[model samples]
Target chain A: MDSRVLRTRRDVLTAAMDELVEGGWDAVTHARVAGRAGYAKATLYAHWPDRLALVRDAFDQVGRMPHHEPTGDLRADLVGELVSFRTAMTEHRLDRALAVLAERAGPVPELVEVRRRFVEDGERPMRLLLAPVLSGARLEAATAMLCGAVVHATLLHGAPPTDEEVEAAVDLVLVGVTGA
Target chain B: MDSRVLRTRRDVLTAAMDELVEGGWDAVTHARVAGRAGYAKATLYAHWPDRLALVRDAFDQVGRMPHHEPTGDLRADLVGELVSFRTAMTEHRLDRALAVLAERAGPVPELVEVRRRFVEDGERPMRLLLAPVLSGARLEAATAMLCGAVVHATLLHGAPPTDEEVEAAVDLVLVGVTGA
Candidate 1:
């Protein structure tokens, strides 16, 4: 709870996150993080017992996503939220992190719960946007489609969706084309 | 090539794949794979010259996906193909592999090409199923949605869809819900 100790903890977590970004999950080790943070290994180990514990603390240090106010116009709101989502992903290289987490989700209950919490938390804002228009499984499915489309387009195809593509996706979810 | 030589190549590739699955992309070093395959390091180097080359060879050794013949029942056929896709993913642990590959795709042209080829080759069969019903960007968007739905449902949710969920996803694509 001491001010200097808090600063040191912040510094260490920042270093761990830097390691994660620079080299990936495999690169986060106590000694490497301690060296980067200008701390003795003993200091890091005294604070966090293991690498996973350190990673969890580092991950928690990431800024919280700000809640978006709905713009009342559905299309504008959807695009705004999606663009914000895309920006966050780009800034953090989150697609890679998500991939790693998703892969580990199977064997690690901690990760599975993490992903579940993420999905639940992420959908909350979208739910507010769609509350008037959509509900239940259909709403959930639509949200997944939109998020998945942006993710695949950005990560796999190497670009964010064109405005046209975004509009098309929105249209499809709102009311699918009839007769094929 | 001599039969003995062919056997050695297969053995080496198999060993490399096991390492890839067990340890990840970082674990595919020539020394480790060669040792696992009972070959000297020189043998691996003589063939691969680098870790990336060995990985490509190992990835290529994964069994080819069997082409699915459409049964002409649109809904049934789509479900059948999706179920098959899900089965293949499970058998090969493909979601995890794809996560790793997609993360590496930007910097690695080989991986990009691999993903491009995979999308092209994988979509060919789906095209046959959809050609009668749809075409153009609509077709492409529909395919991506179906694939994404299956992927998120299976990989993130940790289970393949129930028959009901698959049917619902297909319905949403073919004729999405009206009024949100």
Candidate 2:
């Protein structure tokens, strides 16, 4: 793509994300995004035909998990995973976007797939770190417990888990699952 | 209230729930519900006055926790709680409804309070059952872990946790928290 076209695409996507973060799914429309990006509606339509397409593109740009190298320390590794999860969910407003997509009627199939992929990819590293300690059904159960604690703490409290809370959750899972 | 009036109210609420389950929040307008309930639109207005009122009444009727008597056997009680959580969330379609409500713009204050009340009330019993073994922040953390597992498992798998998954989670929490 030409440099100018690339710049325009980036600008429009950023505007769409801004709309999403400001007012959620309903607020991101082609016209609104075009207005935010200082482009004609026709220009937006020429690139991404619909609201779903723009939102999905914005998600692709912003949705990412933080990397945390395991230190071969089970408790510390688990805390690292929890912190990374919280960072990814809150920083990119993934939780808010997901809450919207879940409520949407007949959500675009690729968008749903995108979320599932994010979850699976996010868990892959943690699963690897803990594999020696747990496997099969046991590993799955442990993953659910730890991840759920982090996610639900955010949902119920509207904030990421404090360091103490994260450590406590990691401790419960580590001691409970591995007898460590 | 007169028996006939009570029946009419029940019918209207049932119709409202059907609209919600079938078409979501936007579909529960007074006109549509009144039409479905075989009442004049004015009747619905007289009873509900608005969409939020209708939704709140329907939730009050359908949003109830399944009663599970704790057996004083900690693992078993926890599993029972998980099962009850799944049943209530899925059967009443409360989880879907809640995901929508959570994403809704400026949600009705009363409806949000209704959900908060449900979550808190549901936790009270499990708190009592686990109090002997855990309390304070530990108890709260444990509750979040178990509840999050059930809820997130449903969110990811699009199905409730199986019996084995439930047992594994309960076992982990029991052993992890209590050193059993």
TM-score of the second chain of model 2 compared to its true counterpart: 0.86
DockQ scores of the candidates: 0.37, 0.51
Across residues B1-180, which tens digit of lDDT does each residue of candidate 1 receive? Answer: 999999999999999877776666778898899899999999889999998888787667764665556888887888788777777667767665655566556445577766666656665676678777765665656666666666665555566556565665666666742333
The reply for model 1, stretches above 4 Å from the true place, is A1-6, A38-40, A66-68, A106-110, A127-140, A177-180, B2-4, B35-41, B106-110, B131-137, B176-180
Instruction: Give me the runs in candidate 2 sitting further than 4 Å from their true place.
Output: A67-69, A105-110, A156-160, B105-111
Clashing pairs in 1: none
What TM-score results for chain B in every one of the models? Answer: 0.84, 0.86
* Pairs in steric clash, model 2: none
Give me the TM-scores for chain A across all models, comma-separated.
0.83, 0.83
Write down the lDDT of every candidate, Cα atoms only. Answer: 0.69, 0.74
Residue-level error in angstroms, candidate 2, position B95: 2.4
Question: What are the fnat scores of the candidates, in the order listed?
Answer: 0.25, 0.46
